[model samples]
Target: MCYVMSYIRMAMCVILFLTLFTGMCVADSKGNLALNGMAVQSSLGHPQGDAQNAVDGNRDSDYKKESCTFTKTEFNPWWRVDLGNVYTVSNVTITNRGDCCKERLRGAQIRIGNKLDNNGNNNELAATILTAPNGTQTFSFESVNGRYVNIFLPGNDEILTLCEVEVFAEKKLLINI
Candidate 1:
């Protein structure tokens, strides 16, 4: 009789512990609720899920496994996501991509908020267009502010190669809003 009673008490303790743990888990998932106010965008191969993925695409960790190369060209071209908001970039991660893929890199550009193309104005190029290094580079941007971002790819006569180019930034809250 004592053994059975002890087992029942143990079972009760487990059930209580599980219930409390579940509550804590819920709070952890919804640790902080953010009110939508600023732009949050990215093209790090996938949707914006974390700060580390600021710039998007495959990186050294996984690129070798998949024979697929990240590519940019004049035809399909590279892209810059508007993130639906503006942010102050803190870091940038560029993953080595492409064996040059089916397409090639002409050149690539990235820019923060500026009225270049949107104004129907031409001749003015992107404010922050970048040249992919011969090798691979992980770069960062700090102390700059802008809203719209631009990415330009002026295809090299040969093809350019890349896996992913990611930008990391801290979301800025607009007081005017």
Candidate 2:
């Protein structure tokens, strides 16, 4: 009788452990959410510097390659991407213009949120570019839930240029055990 009781308790314990573990396990997949997102900027510096180029999955830094975005020289020039749905953003990777003026991206602010106020530039500040990048830089941070990401440069005669902007996030699937 003692042996049978011990075996039954062990079996119950194993079953309980498996059920709790299964419930806690979340299937998550991380991907670039900005790849197919809609992008826009304050103003165009050139016809070839369309905002869509930043999300074209190309990191070509050379403007001549026609894979970068340029904003006309203005105060607080900003660029933004509309992520189709709200996500817990993990990080933001930015490729600077390598052909010529890489310093144009310095002092830029990255904001993320669902609010459309100020063209979404007034959202939560995620990161700031402290110095000019030679090629590319990735800014990782605590997860922020938002549907829009904006890059804003605050100053007069400032030009915002981005070769590529990649937003990474993980989508989690909850499983009920």
Candidate 3:
């Protein structure tokens, strides 16, 4: 009986370990190609309102209460994300602040390419948002292949507040070892 009980306990421990570590083992199993929670940056950012907030998987627009980036009002403020590798981007979804000032996202240009010149301004233009609505907005365009995705707001004095930015592309399957 003692040997049987010990075997049962060992089996239980293995099960628990697998339950906790399975998520880590297959973390990239998402069927879609959206590079969520990846390396991101911006020209201007605050301590609390860091650039990663836009990709932190949170859509809460209130920067004070939630995770979001606030750039100093300046000419051509921009935010960008490196997709790690070049991908055939299908579309990009941006979430605007629902609390206030959703109009600040207007006239923003979404550019995608491998070029880093002039803060990715030289990249091919994917889409230009004329009037961005509140909440999440998905901008679809022809598949553009690039390693970097940039969102630029051109103006003399304007702020760019992005709650969330989701980039979707053609999904790539990974083989788990």
Candidate 4:
């Protein structure tokens, strides 16, 4: 009887562990939250380079393809996305222009938070683009809670362009006791 009880207890423990593990995996697989979000920029560089292009689920680096966003040369040009609701963002993936002038994104700041002050540019500084890349780059850091993600280029006569901006996050799970 004792042996049967111990075996049953061990089996129950394993089952519980598997259940929790599966939940966590499901939460993390929610995919890119920014795909359904809304995007905006400080100024439009061209009609084809609208802010909405960044979240249109296309990562084409060529600005001519109209899949990237562009801002006119100005001080502190910024692009932002509203994620609809607050979420614990895990990482952000940014695709830079590949056709030319990929260096325009250098020194860009990635800020995340719920505050709309300064058009969400005053949010928590999550990361910075230290180097320009011709392809996609993913920036991961400690999870940040926010409904807005802003990419601010702080400098004089700076132009901000983004081929794609993908935001990935784990959904908050509520467990009932």
Q: Best lDDT goes to which candidate?
A: 2
Clashes of each: 26, 0, 0, 0
Measured with C-alpha atoms, the lDDT of residue 103 in candidate 4 is 95
Query: For candidate 2, lDDT tens digit of each residue in 1-177?
Result: 999999999999887887687543344646788996899999999999999999999999999999999988999999999987677787999999998999899999989988999999999999999998889899998877778999999999999999999998767623344
Candidate 4 yields a Cα-based lDDT of 0.87
List TM-score per model, in order: 0.42, 0.80, 0.74, 0.81
Give the clashing residue pairs of candidate 2, or none.
Answer: none
Task: Report the Cα lDDT for residue 99, model 4.
Answer: 96
Error of 3 at 25 (Å): 23
- Residue-level lDDT tens digits of model 3 in 1-177: 999999999998886776576522212323224335454444555677677778777778787866677788788888888776666787898988888888889999999988999888779999998997789889999988777888888888888888888888756422222
Q: What's the lDDT for residue 20 in model 1? A: 66
Error (Å) of candidate 1 at residue 121 is: 11
As for lDDT, the candidate ahead, 2 or 4, is 2
In TM-score terms, candidate 2 sits at: 0.80
Of the two candidates 2 and 3, the one with more favorable TM-score, higher being better, is: 2
Which residues of candidate 2, in runs, are more than 4 Å off? 1-29, 173-177
- Cα lDDT tens digits, model 4, 1-177, are 999999999998886886677432113337788894789999998899899999999989998998999899998999999987667887999999999999999999999998989989999999999999779999998888878999999999999999999998766722221
